[model samples]
Target: MTSTVSSDLRERAEAVLATLAGPGARLREDQWTAIHALVAERRRALVVQRTGWGKSAVYFVATALLRADGAGPTVIVSPLLALMRNQIDAAARAGIHAATVNSANTGDWERTYAAVASGEVDVLLVSPERLNNPDFRDRVLPQLTATAGMLVVDEAHCVSDWGHDFRPDYRRLRTLISELPAGIPVLATTATANDRVVVDVTEQLGLASGEPLVLRGSLDRESLRLSVVRLATPAQRLGWLADHLDALPGAGIIYTLTIAAAEEVADFLRERGHPVASYTGKTDPQERLAAEADLLDNRVKALVATSALGMGFDKPDLGFVVHLGAPASPVAYYQQIGRAGRAVERAEVVLLPGREDRDIWAYFASLAFPPEPLVRQTLAVLGDDAMSTAAVETRVDLSRTRLEMLLKVLDSDGAVRRVKGGWVATGEEWVYDRERHQRIAEARRAEQQAMLDYIDTTGCRMQFLRRQLDDPASERCGRCDTCTTPAWSTDVDQDAAAAAQERINRPGVEVAPRKQWPSGMAELGVGASGRIPATELAEPGRVIGRLSDIGWGTRLRELVDGDDAPVPGDVLDACVRVLAGWGWEQRPVGVVGIGSRTRPHQLDHLARRIAEIGRLPLLGTLTPAGPRPEAHANSPQRLAALWSAFEPPAFPVPNAPVLLVDDVIDSGWTATVAARLLRRAGASAVLPFALAQRG
Candidate 1:
C-alpha cells in the first residue's frame, strides 16, 4: 500500500541500515521519519531523544541516502573524541568512509584533508573547538561549506546556555551554521536537552529553515532502578562501596565530583581487592582509551571517574552507575546515569549523597561570568595584532583556564578573531550581556536546588529527574527504591568501616614545589622569570594531608577555612608520624616559621612542635613586610603580590638544611619565595612542610 517514491526511499534506507544492525534489521519509526525529513525533504531537524536511541544512526543513514543521490559528503561537529570514534566505527558498518579531524588527530590532518578533497571520505567528524581553529577555518572550512551536503551537531544541548554541560566552544557553531549554503540538511541531536535547551537550540540551528522537524521523545527509562544511600561521613561511604561493589550487576561507572575524589576512591577500592581504574581529565589520552576498552570488555569492576567520562560512551549493557557524591544538578546527574539501563532489562543507579557536595557546588559557582570591569579590561587588551594567550595573561588578572575560556566566548561573539599565533580584535562592537549571563547563573542555582530536592524526595526518583527536564509525560517509575523493593544494600560492615577510617586517618601528602617562575614577572615588578635556580629551589615538600583528601580533608578545611585555633593534639601526632615516614635525603638542621596573619596560633604550634620533637634549633621567623597577597589570582599576579612581601629572617643564617613550616599551602608560591630568600641568606637547603594544602 506504500507509495512508489516512499517505498523506494525506505528500500534504500533499509539496505544501508542492514550493514549496521545486520540482515533483517530495521529502523524505528522515528528514526525513519528523521531520515526521510533529511534525505527527501532536504530540511533541517532537531531530534531530542534519550541516549541509546540510535541518534547517530539517523545521521549515518541520512548521509548514505544523500550521498547516493549525488550530494556532497556530510560534516558532523561532535563534542568528544570518544563520540567521534564511535561514530566513525558506526559509519564503517554501513560502508561509509569516515574521517575525523580533532585535537587528537592533528598529525593526520593533511592526509585527511586530501582524502576529503579527493572524494574518498563520505563523512567527516570534528570537535567543536576545531571550528575556530585558524588554519582549518582559513584553509579547509570554506571548501567544505561550498560542497557539504548535510551538517550534524551532536550533543546539541551544549549549544544552549541552559544546558547543564554548556560549553563556550560549542557557541562557535553559530558562525559555522551561518555560513552553510541553503537547503543543506542540518540535524542537531542530543539526549540531554531540557525544554529551554531544546527551544534555544531550535532557534539557533533550525529556525533558519522555518520550523524544522522538531522530534522530542520521553526522557524516562524503564530499565533504571534509582536509589540513594544517605551516608553521614566519608568513611561510611567508602565502607559501603568496599562491602557492596562486587554485588553490582555488571561493569559500570562510579562518578565523583572532583579529580581528587575520583583518584582517592579508585585507590581505596583497588586496595580492597576490586579491580578498578581512575578516569578523569588528568588521565592521559592513551590511558583513557585503555580504560574505556577495559570497561567495555568488563575487564574491571568500574571506572572511577569525574564528568570527563560522561556522554557518548557506548556500552549497551552497562549494569550500573554509582555516584560517590551528588553532582550539582539533577540534569547532569540524569545525563550521567543515562549511560546505564539503555540495552538492559534493569540497571542499578545509586547516589551516595555527602555533606561536601554543596561546598563543591559553591566553589564552582564562584567562577561564573566575571564582572563588567574585567570584561572591558579583557577587550581593551585586544587589538588588530594577534597576541598569544601568554601575552594576554600578562595583562589580565584571570587564570590560564579562565582566560582561554573568555577568548573563546569573545571569538564566538565576533569581538575577536583567532589567527595564526594568537587572537586579534575584529573591530565589532561587543556589548556585555549581563542580563542573559545573570539569568543563566540563576538557572544554575535552581538546578542545584533541584538536585537537593531529588535526594530528599519520597516520590519516584526517575520521575523526579524527568520532571526536571520538563518531560510532560513523566510518570512515577514503578522500579525505583521509592516505588519498589530496594535492590542495593545500605549497610556498612564493621571491618569495612574500620578499614576505611584507618586509611583516611593515615596522612602523608607530598607537596610538589614550584620549580619555575611564572611568565611576565617583570610586569609584576618581580625580576625573576623562567626556571628558578635549582640551588634556590626547595626540596620536594610535605603536607600532613590535602584539604581534598578523604580522612583529614574535612578537619583541615575547618581549620584553614574557618577561624584559627591551636593545632589539635591528634593532628600534631599525625604530623609527627608524617615526619617519621618522610624519606628525606638529608634531615633538617633547623626550623623556620613563615609568619601567619590569620592562623598564627595554629602555624606557630605546628612549627614549634616539629622543632621541639626533632630536637632542632628554631631559626628566626620571617615577618610580613607588606600587605597580604591578593587571593584568587593567576600565577604571575600571585607571584607579583608575594615576591619580597616576606622579610628575610633577621637572625644569622646557618649553611644547612632547615624545615620551613606554614599553616596552609594554597598557591605554593609563598613557600617558593620563602625558600629562595633562605637560600639567598646562605642556607644549604630548604624543605617545606605544611599542615594542609589547598587544591
Candidate 2:
C-alpha cells in the first residue's frame, strides 16, 4: 500500500465510518490503514487491536468500499451469534446489508443464500464451524469462495491452537484462505493475541510466503481501573461481591469459571436484591437472549456469566467487569475484562481469585486432547462407512464430550469428515503428534502460572496482562490499583461472610435417573439398548452438594481427595438438610449402602447415619461381584463395568422405598445401577442420596 491516501477513497470510507459510528466519528489512522490495505491494495491483513478499537469498523468500511467498487460481497467468518447480531446491526448503520448463516438461524439459511445469490446482501457472516458443514462446504462454500470479494475473520486468535480461546474449527480457515482466488482481500482481527499467536494467525491468512499486512496495537485499556481482591475463601468472595457489586461503576458482568458457580452466584445475588441473571452455555436460547438484552439495556445490575458471554457482546457503556475467579490465562482475562470500559470514561475491573481456581483449571485441562491410545482407538473404530457419535461411544471407552472434541481436531486435520448423518474416516494417513500435544499441554500450564503471577504481582495489573500478550508499548497504567489507589474495597464483613457461607454451604443437586441405554451395549456383553426400562430406574434423588459449587464445593473436594474416612460433621448435616428438603412422596423405609471397596467405611457410615436419622432399617451392603467402574470411562464402558457388579443386599430389602447411599455421585451411574439392583431385589422405589456430586 502507499503512505499517500486517495482523496476520494478517504472521503467515501470516512463517510461510511461516520454512519457506522456517530456523526462526529472519524477513522483512526491504523483503522484507515487496514481499510486501505483491504480495499485499495486488495491485500491480506491481520489487525491485532484492542477490544474497543473498532476492528469491525475496518471490515464494515472495507465491505462498503468494495461493494461500491462493484466487487462481490464480503464473507465474514464470525465465531459467536452475539457478535453476528452486532455486526449485522453495524453493517445496517453503514447502509450495508449483512445476513448471517449460523446454527441458530437454520431456517433462514436458504433465504440468506438466495439473498446472496441475488446480490442483495453486501456481507455474509458465518461461524467457522459452518465451513465444515457438509451442505455448507459441498454446496454453498464453493459459490462463496468463487465470488467473495473479501474474507474477514473476526476473533481471529481462534485460528491458532496456541490462542487462549482456540477452536479447532477456526484452523480450517487456513484451507479457505488457501483456496481463495488471488487478490481477494482477507482481513483477520482479534483483540487478544500474543506474538506467537500473531505469527500463527498471520500464516493462517495464506499470504504465499509474503507476510500479511500485520498491524498490532498496544493492548492496554486506559479507561479500565484494574485491581485484585485476594479473598481467602469462596464465602468471603461471595460476600464481598454481594455487598459491593452495586457500588461499582455501572451494570456489567460477573464472570465465573463454571456454570454451577454462575447459577449459584446469580441466585445468591438475586436473593440479596440484586437484579442479576445467570448466563451459561446450558441456558435456554430465549433466556440467554433476554439476559443479554437486559444487560445491554441496563435493566439488570449484572449478568452472572461463564465464557459463553466471551465474544460478540457489544455494550459500549458497560461500567464494570468482576471476575469471581481468575481466568486460566492472561490473554483470556484481558479479552473478558475488555467487555468493560469500551465506551466509558472509567470502568472497574476487579479480580477475586479463589483457592479452587487451580482445581477448576485442572478440570478443564483434563478435557484436552486425549491420550494416544484413546485417539488411536477412536480412529480404529471409524471405518469408511459413517458411524454416529453414539455408536462410537459404545465401541470406545471415551466420554461423548471428549469424543466430539477429538473428532473436531481430526476433522480439522482431514483425518475424518462429518458427513450428513455421522462421521467417517477419510482413509487418509493420520499421524498423532505426541510432541505437539505435549507442548500445548506445557503451554497451558505456563499460561495458568502466568495468571497466578498476575494475581500476586504488585506492579501495574494492566501492564502485567499487556506484557503477557507481548504488547511492545506496555507501561504503568496509572488507573490500576497498584499505580493508583485501590478502587475496590477488600474488606468482607462478618454479616456478608455469614450470608455467603450459608448460601454456599446450603447444597442440593438433583440426580435425575439415566433414561437412555448406551447403543451397541450388546457388543459389550450388556443387553441394554435404547431406553432403560422405567420399572428398573431409580426415582429422582438428591445430593448434599456439588463439588463444583462455590462454598460446599471446597469442603466436598477436600473430603473426596482425602483418605477414606467417616463423613465430616458439616457434610452429614448437609445431607440431613438435603434429605429433609427432598420432600419425596414415598419416604424410604430402609437404607442400603452402595457396594464400595475403596471407601467402604465412608459409605457404611453414610448409610447407617441416614438410616438412624430416618428411623429406618439398615440393610446389609450390596457386595460387589466385579471390579469397580472407571470414573471417567465412557458411558457404555462404565455401565459394562458395573453390570453384575452388585447383587441384592445380604438382607432382604423390604418392598418399600429404599434410601441408596453412596459416597459421591460423579457420573451418577453407580447410583443408578445400585438402585436398579435393590429394586429388582424387591424395593418398590429407590431414592439415591450422596454426600457430594460432581457438576
Candidate 3:
C-alpha cells in the first residue's frame, strides 16, 4: 500500500541510519513507522518510547531525507543544553548540519541564525525558553516556523501542565505549533509520560487536518534491576552509599532532591576518596559540560546531581542510578532511572527514601498558581507598560519564581505578551481555568502519596512503577529485589555513620551579601538601582545552616516554626563554634540584635549569649519603627517595607565591626537595610549573622 516516494524515503532513511549507528544499524519497525508518518504522510506524530529506543534516530534520519528533498531546516525544541550537544553530534554523523541557540551560546546566536537563514544549517536546536524570548518570538521565530521542514518537540510531556516536570516555557510551544505552515510535519517525543500525560500531549498536539499518530511502546526496561533500601536516618543513608557506591557496576549518577543535599553528599564522598563531582542548578554551565564529559570518559565514579541533570543527558553505558531521596512522583523517578541501563546488559537502580521527602514536596506545592484574585491583581498591575519581572514583583505578593511562571501562563493564554522591554497586557479577554488548576493540584498530591506507597511496597518494584505509569502490559520483572533475592547489602559501618554525622553536624554556611539593588525601585518610591553602594552593603555574612540542610535544618525549622522559645543550648554551642571558625579579617567588638516582631525574645537571648561568650559590650537594639507588612511579599516590597522600619540608636558603637544577630534570614533585604542604618550610625563595619538561611 506504500507509494514509490514512500519506498524511496525509507531507503534514504536506512542509509542515514547506517551513518549514525554504524554499518550494522537498521531502523526498528517503529522507528521507520515514525519516519514514514513524518516524511511520507506529512502527519503529526507522538512517539513515546523507552530510553535507548532509537527515538533520536528517527528524527535525524527523517531530517536528512527531508533536507535532501529541498525542505527547509528541521527545528528541534530540546529541553537541556547537554541534549542539544548530543543531538548536534548525532546530526553530524548522519551528514546533517546543526546549530544551537541557548543561554550558553549568546555570543554565537547571530552567526548561527545567519547560517540557518542561508540554508547552510540543516537543523536548529533550541531550548523551550527560546520560544518565549522576545526577539526570537518576534523576529526569528516567524521566519523559522514559516520555512521549517519538520518541527520536533523533544521531551514533549513538559508541554502538559499535568506532567511531573511541567515548565511554563514549554506551553509557549502551542503558539509555535499553531503558527507553523500547513503540511509541515510535527513530531513530539518523550521517554516517561504516563497515560494521562500521553492523552494530554496528544490533545495539545492536535493537527490542522486530523488527529496525531500516537505510538507508545512498552515502558519496561528488562536490564534495570530495581530495589529500595530504607535506612533509619540521613546519616545511615549517607553511610550506606559510602559503603556500597563503588560496588555498583560502573560510573553513574547519585540523585538528590535538593542542591544542598547534592553538595553535601558529593563532599562526603570526596572526603572518603571517591572521585565524584556535583552537578546542580547552581553549577556553572561550563563546569556541567566538563562533568558530563568526565562521566562519559569514565574519569569519575559518579556525578552527585539534583533534578537539574534530568531530562536530556545521555550516556549509553551508564551502569547505575542511586537516589539519595525519593522524588515526589513515580513518573519523575522512572525518568531519572532511565538514564541508566541503556546500552548495557544490566544496571542497578536503588532508592534511599528519606522521611523529609514529603516536606520538600509540600514546599514545592505551595508555589502553585494562586487563586483568581491574585492572578487578576497581577494583570491589573501591567495596564499599558512593559514592566520588567522585578518591577512586577514589586507590585505582586508572589515569589519571583512563581510570579514568572504565572506570567508565562498568561502569555500563553493570550492575556499578555513578552516584548523586548518586559511584559505587556494583550487586551484580550482571559478566563482563569480554576477547575483545571484544582485538578492538577489534586493529581500532584496523589502522585506524592504514590511515591510514599512505592517506598513501603513489598511487591515487585518495577511492577509498581509500571502500574503508576498506567502501562497496559504491566508485569513483575524477575530481576527486582522482591522477585529475586536481595541484590544489595544494606549494612552501614559504624565509623562511616559517625563520619557522616560529624560532617553533617559541622555548621556555618557563608551568606553572600546582596550586591545589586533590585530593579524598578523608583516605582516603589525607593531611590536605588544597579549596584549597591559598597559602603552601605553588608560584608559577607554567615548562617549556622541552610533551612534545607540534613543536620541543622530540622532543628532550625522547628525553632523558626515552633512557638516562641529561647535558643537551645546545642544551637548556641554551634553558634559559638561558627564564631570560632569565622576567620573574619576584623573581629566583632560588640553585638546588636535586630528587633523581631514575633520572636523578639529569641533574638534578644541569642544576642546576649554571643556578647557574653565574646566578652564584648552589648550595643543597643535596632527597634521596629512601624507595623509589619505581609510575610510573603516579593523582594522590592520587602525592601520598601524595611527601608524606614528600622530605627537605629543615635549613639555611635565601639570602633570595631558589629555583629547583627537575627533568628532567621529570608530575603536579606532586612539585613541590607539594617546594615545601612548601623553604618550611618557610625559603626566601623556591620556583619550580619543568622541562625538559619531560608532558600
Candidate topping lDDT: 3
> What is the lDDT of every predicted structure here?
0.88, 0.88, 0.89
Give all TM-scores, in the order shown.
Answer: 0.97, 0.97, 0.98
TM-score of 3: 0.98
lDDT of 3 by residue, 190-297 (tens): 998888898888776554247788888888998999999989888999988988888999999999988998998999999988999999999998899999999999
What tens digits encode model 2's per-residue C-alpha lDDT throughout 1-695? Answer: 34455767999999998998889999999998899889988988889998899999999999999998999999999999889998999899989999999888899999999999999999999999899898999999999999999999999999887898878888788889889888899998999999888888887556535557988887878899999998888889999999898799789999999999999999999998999999999999889989999999999999999999988899999999999999999989999999998888999999999988999999999888889898998899998888988788888777888888789889978899899878999889899899988998999999999999999998988889888999855468888889987877779878888999888878788878887887778878998778878778889888877888888888888897798888878778888889888988978887888878788888888888888887888877888876665554688888888887886567888889888888888777787788778878898999888877887
**Worst ten in a row by lDDT for model 1:** 202-211
Q: Candidate 2: TM-score? A: 0.97
Ranking by TM-score: 3, 1, 2
Q: Which runs in model 2 stand beyond 4 Å of their true positions?
A: 1-5
How many clashes does each candidate structure show, in the order listed? Answer: 0, 0, 0
lDDT-sorted candidate list, best first: 3, 1, 2
> What is the Cα-based lDDT of residue 308 in candidate 1?
95
> Residue 298: error of model 1 in Å?
1.0
Residue 614, model 1, lDDT: 89
